[model samples]
Target: MNFLIEENRNLAPYCSMKAGGNAKYLVQPKSVSELCEAVAYFRSRDEKYIVVGNCSNLLFPDSGYDGAVIITCGIRGISYENGVITAHCGDSLSSLARVACENSRAGLEFCYGIPGTVGGGVYMNAGAYGGELSQYFIRGSFIDKNGEIVVIENNDMDFGYRHSRLNYEELILLSAEFSSVEGDRDAVRARMEELMAKRKASQPLEYPSCGSAFKRPAGHYAGALIEQCGLKGTSVGGAQVSVKHAGFVINTGNATATDVTELLSLVSDTVFNETGVRLEPEIRIIK
Candidate 1:
């Protein structure tokens, strides 16, 4: 087939954290059709496979993955029409937000600075600063385990606080449509820039990190709790709790997955000991 495939590919370069080992096999699909074909190929062989885009919120183990890693970042495409954006799964969330602003479409300005892809954002119901992906979701399509295309509406997505029904199923996202409201272009851009500035000031944007390490606890914020426990700037090898934002664990330099995993456990245990609340990681770790 006319598809790109690599052997023993270093996965660190593919992830934002840049701390993972290699993937035995990596597939880069440039379109929805190619993604489907790649899935079918791996499935027919009864081999393990995963659909990934951006890898911004993932923490891969140092041992590396033994199966096929199908990367859809190459499948990028997007268009805006009639107050709606139809975008491929691989399209960057930032790009989508920019397009919306350019079209004078509001509501997606919150996603303007999120470092993830459309598929990843939809899968996790990504949100920031009082805005969530589910709010604008209309419908989408995915390839089910049976190799059939399944169309899902917003209701069927089952979006909830950084989660979606897609998380529970063995399906690959293809594309999605999001609805937005008409607003002043200047206002949208200004809001986006404001949010970005806030993020830079409060977050450890200079370091490589998996964004927020812990999900927000019901009654307390993760960063606040970490700071309360005096865990800011804590480090396990090259992995360190961000001094700027205690909620994030950043790779100072040459950090291994083991260091990150150990650091996460330490933070979780310490936080739970200091407070009754238990902090759970928001980033997905692959062993």
Candidate 2:
């Protein structure tokens, strides 16, 4: 496969939190073909491997991974034709949103500030500010566990709040298509900018975090619950709950995965004790 390969790579620089250890082997596939080839190669060798993009909502263990890490960030592309978008799995959701705005498509403006890739967004049904990827999803293509390509329509995606069929299916996404409405370009851009501004003002953007630490529970916001519990600015080692946004567990400096994990547990336990609600972590922890 024509892909970049590295040995003993530090994973901290890849993830948003910047607090992980290292990977024994890291492979960067530049295209869907390359990705599939690499996957097949790893499978044939019976090597444990994990595919990732952006690493925005993931936490890697300090002890590090002993397997191969395949990064699809190089497999990015976005195209729009007649109000429809076809995006590669590794394409940045934020960049895709900008492309939509440039094409005068309105529906994807909500994705403008999400710090994730199209594959991850689709897998998690990523959403914010009342809009979700499922809302515009039309169809997607992925490689299944058997190394065969499969395509699924929106109806087959089984999308829900922070959930999707990808959770149960052993599939590696390659690309996806989305439907959009024709709209005023200026209005779309304005809405995108407005949402971004709101995020900057309310979120702890200055610090290293995996965005929201916990999922929104029922009708209550995680941030509100955390703040109400007086957990803001709470710290365990170098990890702290952000004062600006109680929902985020931020890395102040030199935080370890253990520190973040411990802090998350503390915050969850404290919140549950006070509110009688158990908070679920939104970040995926890779041990």
Candidate 3:
């Protein structure tokens, strides 16, 4: 399998937050087979690498990464058979929901505006409005550290509040299947549009962010806690808690990874001090 290896590539553009440095080596796989080949190649060469898809919720340090960054965004495909939908790791979660709606299938409407790919989504068990991927997720294929493909079922995913076995495992997702029941396409689309409207109204979509900045504390909303502490519009360098949504720490044009991390820490501390609820950041802070 032929592939290109880019060196000294800027990593900021790859992340949704648009705040990062550079990578020493980068491999973008164009297909699942290519992804497997790339992983095997790197593993055999004893080269350190980190797999990423979409980079929506990831924060790369400004100092940059010295090893291979294996990006799966180019490996995308989706299909529907009977009541099940199969998607490549690089497939967009939003696109998956839309395809489900198109096939007259309900559920997954909450994924409409999510910016991550299936690999990232499943790794974190992404959800919204009480809808979670684990609900419909059946099983998936992953590439182990040895470069061998392995299958894991829903029962083994260990899904819980934005957590999954992918958190502790060395495997990387390749593809997954989901099941959805039949529904009226019109109603499904309408519901999706309504949710999107709400998102636009409530989120700081005009600024680049990692969606929500913090996980919701048990019986408490992260945003409300930040808002209650009068932390809205707070800024650390170019990173600011969104005035539009206290839950988001947005990059105000020139934000750096340090700025974002500082702002996140400040918000979490302030919220905890005032509300007694320690907020755990949802963003992945990568070195």
Per-candidate TM equals 0.99, 0.98, 0.98
Tens digit of lDDT per residue, candidate 1, span 1-287? 86877889999988989898889889999988889888988899988878899999998789898899988899989999999999999999999899999999999999988999999999889999999999999999989878999998998888999899987987778999999999999999999999999998998999999999999999889999999999999999999999999999999998998999999999999999989789999999987
Measured over all alpha carbons after superposition, the RMSD of each candidate to the real structure, in angstroms, is 0.8, 0.9, 0.9
- Give me candidate 3's TM-score against the actual structure: 0.98
lDDT of 3 by residue, 1-287 (tens): 58899999999999989999999999998998888888888888888889999999899999988889999999999999998999999999999999999999999898899889999999989999879999999999998766788999999999999999988889899999999989999999999999899999999899899999999899999998899999999999999999999999999999999999999999988888887899998999987
For residue 176, give model 2's deviation from the true position in Å.
Answer: 0.3
Show pairs that collide, candidate 1.
none
Off by over 4 Å in 2: none
- Ten residues in sequence with the least summed lDDT for candidate 1: 1-10
lDDT of 2 by residue, 38-93 (tens): 99988999988998889999999998888899988888889999889999999999
Candidate 2 minimal-lDDT segment of 10 residues: 1-10
